[model samples]
Target: MGWVNTHTRELFDGYYSLDITYELLLGGYYPTGINANSNYVARDLAALGLILSPQPPTDPLKVVWKTIWSAKVPGKVALNAWRIAANILPTRRNLSLKGYDGDTGCVLCSHDPEDSLHLFINCPYASDIWSKAGLQWSVNGAASMHECLLATLPRLNKEEVNKTLMLRWGIWKNRNSQVWEQKSKHASETFLITLGWYEDVKRSNASPVVRCRQGVKLVKPRAGQFKMNCDGAYIPSTRRGGVGCVSRNSEGEFLAGASRPHALLTSPFHAELLALKEGLRLAMTLQYTEITFESDCALLVQAFQQEDQDLSTMCLLIYKHASGES
Candidate 1:
């Protein structure tokens, strides 16, 4: 490969592209097509073109994006802000712009057309929620969600950012309720509810993972019957996946266990299906006629129980060993 331009910072001992080149494309080093620690490089590399513009920097939208991602909020909440910043929300004004023929008034306040900017920042409902958050100062002088967030998020601490994102999400939720359920919630009420939600999430994240696992342990089934628990995991970064299965007797004794790592698997749902297939195969191979399969993934189990499960390619695999199960 020829020499490439990269900053002497952030990755690969001084180069930028080489890290992705070595981690994602170097098949010999990562046959599984993912780096260790599951930091798949595909997503970051996919956005390389966006950052490598031909001209110099000055896009405030980029700053808005950076702030949205950096905010310590739930992914969905952050995503809501991102959509608002990008002016891509499916607000009534946007729908009409896209040729939708219907009412385009603001759902909460009938003062003006409902765009992302108005719905999230300008409308009286949103303004009330912002006041409840005690950050009305940020919105008083801003024109768009992008501008408001770019200025507000960078100056605030982590907790404030979380509150802001949650409040935004709650406002959107309130709008949805008004549209779909005809239920108009108060803006201050929405703010208080979302504030409580944010605090709960923050506390949950702050607690140690070890505390959650303290009392949880696998239990074996009754003595004569057999049970198999299967699970699968997939990493989005590298499209790498793995499936594992363990069987136990009624006496609560381990009988057999097996796992397989996979590459290019589509999703955790796909992996869960593979895990079930592997479990069925394991049980049949061991000649266990009374084995009951188990998986924490409800979607996989639900698909298997569906009347016609052939909707997906992986669903077909679940049937391969079905006729042989007791």
Candidate 2:
């Protein structure tokens, strides 16, 4: 209490090679006054792996130093090191990063990316895949492509999030492969491949199928009233799915409603499970306390209680999510 902290650009030791004071003051991690004045050099001294082939490398540091110094490509290590330091970079992109000089419209839809949502979700090709997957997507007046992806994250769970991420990765990879490799496949095919990958992972685990317990804070219902309505639809064409739901007050007054389509395809049982997920998501969104989820698929409802669904595919995804074992 006798002396107060002061802001200065003094360094602690000579380990780290950057100005810690500037980062602490300007970075979002620290927003205080006195704490921002402190300066410290952060360094990792973890041991590195060694190679035993040919001549055993006595020191791992020497090997790493030699690799960095001997690289033919100039600035390669520096650029790659920067990327490693910033781990939050995206692994995929929804649109051609190459800005349109003449072609302002999306190649897939001929729509403007000014809103950014059109580049990824609102395009006709994207919409078709979504429809095949049984989702009805809408943009919330997004101004950038990143915003659209951010908006989608809050609506997805671990399973749904993984599927969404893989779909994006596959789509981006397909686009690049088509341009460079001169091989093109329809969006529908890519989506099917994504679904197959998800199924393969689940089946490899050999887990039983059941509805994973999802806790959602729902709105409380008034006396003698229902609070939510759930609906399920299955598309035989793509074996894709759509789930729609609405929340209502005790008087049956509408509060909010939503519909989502999935890009993966599977049996009717999986579609039914998707419907349940959609209903639960909607219920959570409206904070409904007493949710009355309804579905036309009876087999799916039974699968929710059964230990094993015996679905030809989608069993692992179902079990992984339902059991929360993963």
Candidate 3:
């Protein structure tokens, strides 16, 4: 007579609820019959000894996080770079460690294990792309992904870091296309595409008005009218802000200018409103009667033009100043 597998039988028989038995048999738990909660997958992975417990970062990892996230790269590119540095990217090697059974060879070169470092830094294809892009540093001798990033970041300026991150992203994208669509790109082609992307990003970050109005002369105010131009600047890293305002005559000759730093952290909108308020106060003090206030912040200007029930702190301050209550 054949014997039933005792361990499997015990697992099924020991469960008191149908739900628990179903969860064990199907390899997932559905708290709600039709809709599974989002955390169930994470919980299931944790129970299978697949997911590692979270730990506090060491000093080096903290530095790497700060450097990657604070780079002037785009948000998605920066996030991917951070994931690569953290070794959390779903490379074939990482997926295999997480219980997936698949080929773990580098998809680009297929000669080495597809770890984050190998795919991004140590791969011959990646090295070729770097060389074609004219980057000075090579990741051939770097010990690990974090070490490579730490060493590479210090040598690159903001623009170079942005380009480097974009190149890494481009390589990953090309690898995916090759795997999924059976399409492959040459290193020179990838480099050219990444360069085009970087140029587009640079252009998008430039002032639209300035780009459109190249070589156009600025219009001056009418005679006997003084124009008060206000602007604000804020730095996210330091959480500091400053405001400046300048009064110029119709001839574009500066009459007065004032600049002051904020005592506390604030948003750019608040800083711009404060600058406009200060400019109004300065004009009144300087006895300029026919003064036109101007600022690049179109939203703040529109807020002043139309009366609404905006209860924001910045709106309240703007309302007060615009109504001559301050």
Candidate 4:
């Protein structure tokens, strides 16, 4: 007598899988509690005992109403349950390929089915591009996408993993959009879009750091409060990066100071973002929730306030960490 209840509404109505109910009564998922008169499941089981079994009992709704009367759950808990159900529920399978008129081969590599694995890791174009990006993905020899991800986990840091997941989602979405909407974007275009996904996620934190020496107004902290200033330098040809940060009290006395060098060559904008990110992290560590943020880079400050229109790819991460999830 195995019982199943797919819909939650049915479960609340004192209706349960007969097998599951029996299992619960016999002490399974949770420990058996005292058979109190006010208890829902236990009380119901005591009432039904042998009176309702073998042939499915009618008035299942009556049992449900009795249970609800016995146990009143919080509305917020119910709301959370709904949210969890929506996120974890199994979705409709992809039957779009059966309707595809083009060759069964992949649109990007022209060698395999347009499955999740092929579009993300198995395609030749994707594999080579990932390799060039410094991730040593075994394009030809990998058996499955899961294997590829597992193998690459050690090589991919947190930032890289986030980027990889977003890029994979972007690639899969682009493939579907192109085929279904007839957008007809090139493989490189899809790849670039995938890269852009990282920037989108990080957009909130990418504001450039301003120099304290600049004309930008540095809001001094209130009495007994603290503040910090930070900036970054980037030289494209040298592939060198530098970050500087200084923390001070309301009296303008230095509390902390730090700077570091990075080997990778990057543009001035990237350098500014790096400095801001570092500064924000330091401020967060010091437990300052409402501290002044100033940057010599007008564009970066403006972007932080959403007073500017344009956003660069390099600063997306800085923006995300600073604003959204910080």
Candidate 5:
């Protein structure tokens, strides 16, 4: 048998010897030796085939519907409401439909059949919570949980909608607590808790202002000394670059300024070094004895102060120029 390189796929003309014994190479296949009786059928089925299929393209409305629950609304209460609207919540009615036998009456109030609509929208407890939160329109005429959420989209402003979502979520939590933990909260208490949460969220999102003392001004250099300011700019799309420098006296008067484009593409760090180099060159050519060069790159400044050897090509060049070796 001929052998071929796996990467280059080049066939080798020379014969090669096998390292393994012939008996082992020619041995027949054996069972995995795992206990078949102990194997889970579901786990076996899941591992037997490809895990995922390519997701089909979805439309705008379907996308909107799917993401409605995850919108910028606060609290787990809104999430519960969204689940109810999507009919995914494990309500008694839904569980019954899925072959689970259980009484589908409202857990809070046994008068109406328990569903998303009846539990969230038409329930007297939920209605009282909404009324206390100053949202009477939520329980007025919403036939379904989805209709109730949709009605809030246009009728209420952003803050009101957030409050509505929080209220719905809070009511669901209260119901769950009563059923599962045997703990009940009044409608007023639920509303107050939800309002407190909303207020906390608002305060956290508020932008803070930093105070600074006024009358601070830039300090100019002393007489007979020139200050040189240098900066660089680079365009990523074109891979082109440019460097600029300006010299000013102690009186803040512009002495000279130079702007030049780089023919070769380079990094911002390298470009900054080039600008400083050019500015120093200009100052030397002008016979300036004392000149203070300034740049905004902190890394470049740190490199000048330290003696560590940087092996990068640009950094080496910068080091060479800064040390007057170039």
Candidate 6:
């Protein structure tokens, strides 16, 4: 069943229409993704058995719940996301459905019904808030608030996602205050709490390295520690790149150096990230623990220095080696 014979392909004209090429990194070995560190025959058999078993249908909304749960947001923020997505939020439309006598028109924008989608995404006041926050999203046609946020959540990095969650909850809080207290808050005042959440996430260990025109001079390590300096170089003409690593002791004496050229590099930023991975691998291989890594890539170094849940691709790759995953 896995193989499509030539006759089968010809009989089904719509089969295998795309042209594709692949370079195999492994050969002659079955890739049992759920196998243990030491491969076993039984594990492979079990994996195959599970794959062959009849599986129940999947729920698309479950994926949205997974994303919300995985984000490093506060518990209340996640609850708010769930309530809004499940269509249980006490917006004017929802309350009216529960026999509320209050007006269903949006308190902030009297022109539209205060449903979750309109109150949070499509209303003029909400649009103004989003624009003020430097986001331009108009989801008037979206079926729900969940659909509007889920569309963009995949593109945002971890930091952006956390901030977005906090910001949306803050906006809701502001909306509630305006509804009951009958006093409006300024745009800046409304999101002051959201800004605090962002500041708190970036407050610890977020020391950004200063870039200089002359070049950043390597700082020598303290006693009993080793310093690893790294830099990534790219040649646009050949579309190739290279990285260099140098280890120094407390006296600023070079102990070891390594450099390897890259092939078909996409960008200078990618080159820098690759260089960081190499430096980390080298340090771990050398069994060095008291080490301070220095890199010329400001964004990369700053990301490592930060103490938040950074699920960005760059941060994940750096931690992949540490976790001993191939």
lDDT for each residue of candidate 6 in 266-321, tens digit (9 for 90 to 100): 56766787777677778888889899888778777787779986544455545654
What TM-score, over all chains together, does every model reach?
0.46, 0.33, 0.46, 0.36, 0.42, 0.45
lDDT of 4: 0.55
Alpha-carbon RMSD of each model: 23.8, 22.7, 20.3, 19.1, 27.0, 25.1
Regions of model 3 farther than 4 Å from truth? 1-58, 138-140, 210-326
The residue pairs in collision within model 2 are 134-261, 135-260, 135-261, 212-322, 218-287, 218-288, 218-289, 219-287, 219-288, 219-289
For candidate 2, lDDT tens digit of each residue in 210-234?
8877665555566755655666667
Which residue pairs of candidate 5 clash? 77-169
Off by over 4 Å in 4: 1-219, 307-311, 314-326
Every candidate's lDDT: 0.73, 0.52, 0.74, 0.55, 0.67, 0.69
lDDT of 4 by residue, 226-306 (tens): 777878888778889898888888989988867878677346766777777778778878887667765677656756666
| lDDT over C-alpha atoms for residue 212 of model 6 | 67
Stretches > 4 Å off in candidate 5: 1-71, 75-78, 138-143, 209-326
TM-score of 2: 0.33
Q: Give the Cα RMSD of candidate 5.
A: 27.0
Cα shift from native, residue 323, model 3 (Å): 62
Q: What residue runs in model 6 are displaced by over 4 Å at the alpha carbon? A: 1-54, 138-140, 201-326
Q: How far is 87's C-alpha from truth in model 5 (Å)?
A: 1.4
